[model samples]
Target: MKKTGLTIAAALAGALLGSPALAQKTVLTVGMQSTDAGVLDPHLNSGTPGKAMLQWMFNGLVRIKPGELSPEFMEPDLAESWTSSTDSKEWTFKLRQGVQCHHGYGEFTSEDAVYSLARAASKETSAFSSDYAAFDKVEAPDKYTVKITLKQAIPSLLGIVMNYHGGNMVCKKAAEELGKEGFAKKPVGTGPFMFQEYVPQQYAKLVANPNYFRGKPKLTEILYRFIPSDSSRDLAFQSGEIDMMLGRQEQAWVDRMNALPGVKVVAMGPAEMSMLHLNMSQPPLDNLKVRQAIAYAVDRNAIWQFRGKNISRPAVSVVPSGYLGTDEKAPLYPFDLAKSKALLAEAGFPNGVTIKAINTTLPSMLSFTEATQALLKRAGITLEIQPVEHATFHQQIRQDLSQVVHFQAARFPIADVYLSQFFHSRAIVKTPTAVTNFSHCKVADAEIDAARSETDKAKQLALWKTAQEKIIKEVCAIPVNEMMQLWAYKDSLDLGYDLKASLNLGPPVLETTRFTK
Candidate 1:
């Protein structure tokens, strides 16, 4: 009997050694580009770093197909199936059974879905409340069915419900028990990973969910570390301390990282547009000619050169290029220093104008603002930059403290989402229903509103074009350039799919992600 048992144990040990899964690394360490996570609440957390961590721990009713970015590739996630009314104002979703929420919050059902959507629609609870302004109500008629009624038709209901922004679902029981402040630190969701721990200014750790509806994640754990310095993150990757990292968006950095042995650098699309919002409510900038002069002083090509051409492109309109309804023919102020000087002088600033601006200390943003500062200086405009922590910068700008705000963002790839949030009068900063209108711009409000509910595709596009023309003519903001997402990872990491683009602003680590060796 003893001899037989010994032989069985030896065979089992041999099998384990020969198995590919046993040889693969189970822990994935990633280096992000922020000092820390701002919040974990799916509806309120808007920062890219926070979104990257949240993507692993949450799921929407539906999700954009893995390895795809467009809404056309969306597939059912928590919801098994869904249907919409003929007018596209009412959507009904049938939830999948046995979907478990993290931290033993119990199964996710229609109740959780209804509660999540209502919370997301509340201005007091959600930063993206304006996105759901058209939402009338959400109801759960059964344990596994949810219905959403909207006040007006949007460009796409799927775009709002997919796993981005306010669409990510939260655990109903967990949220009620933890409350708002508590939930922000320890969010509960139905994704493949469960929140394990978060150390401020350091890292947020997650462990795989064994009961994930799809399947168990091959990665047993994920460590999302915050290394704000480029050199530090690069060194960590080289030393194998991190499996992946957010790469710096510059040609030199990309070339250097690609040259490293066993390292692969990737540049993905769905670029984020960087625009300079000259506050129309603030003096100096409030003057129309002054704003146009600032626009003329900005050289989009020079900005494109600063960031590599491969990862950056000149933005032709208020709406980003490649997005729906982008009008490439929208007028642009040429890079004419003499015109800029003449305009500045005409605005009664012969000795150069001084403008105060608050800037984020994030490396990429600081670099861009510094470039803009140099450009404006040549046109006899002195841009006084007050650099602050990323979070503080966002707060101060929203409080209407900055004369000029250099904001970069990517929203749903539609004209209405971009125009309504940035150029509409209702979204003006410091207001009760503020979204992100830092410029206090209302030039295109009429056109933007008309395009939102327009059924005719041709008329919708025409309205959007008119909106872009009006916004550009008013010089509310200077559309600088679009920057694509970039990252560096180990060649051995499979990532589970081909990653062309991601709306989460980072690589999505799914159940199949595993190291080859």
Candidate 2:
């Protein structure tokens, strides 16, 4: 027998209009490891909860297809259509009609779009300020059209920039009325869900928007719970305390969950890169030879096996695989101890070297830190790993506190976004304009700039590859592995999409997500 694509609405119709199998779903509670939502201001909320919340609470001018990570899958979102000038410096977007702002903020228009971009480009508020350094100005033509003029052309604007959180629309009147503190506590946007309550380090609750333009959300309510401990979260999932649990990076954990009755675990692909971040401004690590030694010391393959061969693959480039221009054959450290020790000796550390770095509670970071610590020890390098609270760890890392940083993140679904945010000199940490440049190692800045400016896709990709090759060649930091994201949920749950891969690891429980009959 063939199984039909059973939509929630169809299932409900069959129940009342035909026959009943199980009750319809209206709410779902998901357990995650993030401690808090941080700042819920769309520009500042770079954390997992904040990112997921932003998607639910706001709509971008342009958006990637739901549950799709590829750049080719982008579609019209807030802006129904848009056009660019010949030079690609100026872009005009025609705003969609009747898109009301969440909670009577007034109908969304070009004004909100301009305001949000202006705010995002503000140094005081936005982490993405550096990414938009090329912006000249934004204008609202009449009330339904927005014109963004960039000082320099950015080739990746359409595929990435417009769809990101920084570009997501926010009602000008509502945001200004609430102010920074008020806005963080309660945000208003034009999405299917509306903010209900935020409990800080515990849970953030959101209710379905009745007046949503795309029709009301299927789930009446969605609650996000913060559970930092891996074991505790797994236990909660087993006990059915949480409807969904974020899976650990380890294979054994996922296998155990899969073995459980009435439980299903999904390993989502092209997750993100887990990199061995080296602070170029810091001591022995400041030496390129030392950085190369560190890279050659660790075994990316073995470390990946610790998680599972099926769930992860060795990172070949800083941008990682799956994104366009990410070469599968990109160069990497071959895990040679003798060569690493030789490089260390050449870098003025003959016998051994000790490096201090902090680790987060997140399984990805902790696992990388611990696994690499042993490998480095074997190569006569001692790595002191200090575990820090996730929030504190983020603050300290940006302040240039650690010599090495083992971080995992899916920055964006494009090559430019990842390269610019992580490698660009303007994005250096602790400076007035700071983003996520953990290593503070400048590699091919001019090349990256040229790539962004290049209108031709082939040339842009070539320049991006050139920049990444320079990074790998300079041994700025070690590219460890790109891990898989696993989510454990009840068997009855039926997410509308095929769950192939997600741009972000969050389960796509949109208006279509429900339970099967």
Task: Tell me model 1's lDDT, rounded to 2 decimals.
Answer: 0.90
lDDT of 1 by residue, 89-201 (tens): 99999999999998788999999999988888788888888888888889999999999998999896777777888899999899999999999989999999999999988
Estimate, for each residue in 216-269, the C-alpha lDDT of model 2 and write its tens digit. 777889888988888888888888778887788778887788889998788886
Best by lDDT: 1
Q: Count of backbone clashes for each model?
A: 0, 0
lDDT of 2: 0.80
Off by over 4 Å in 1: 1-23
Candidate number with greatest TM-score: 1
- Clash pairs for candidate 2: none
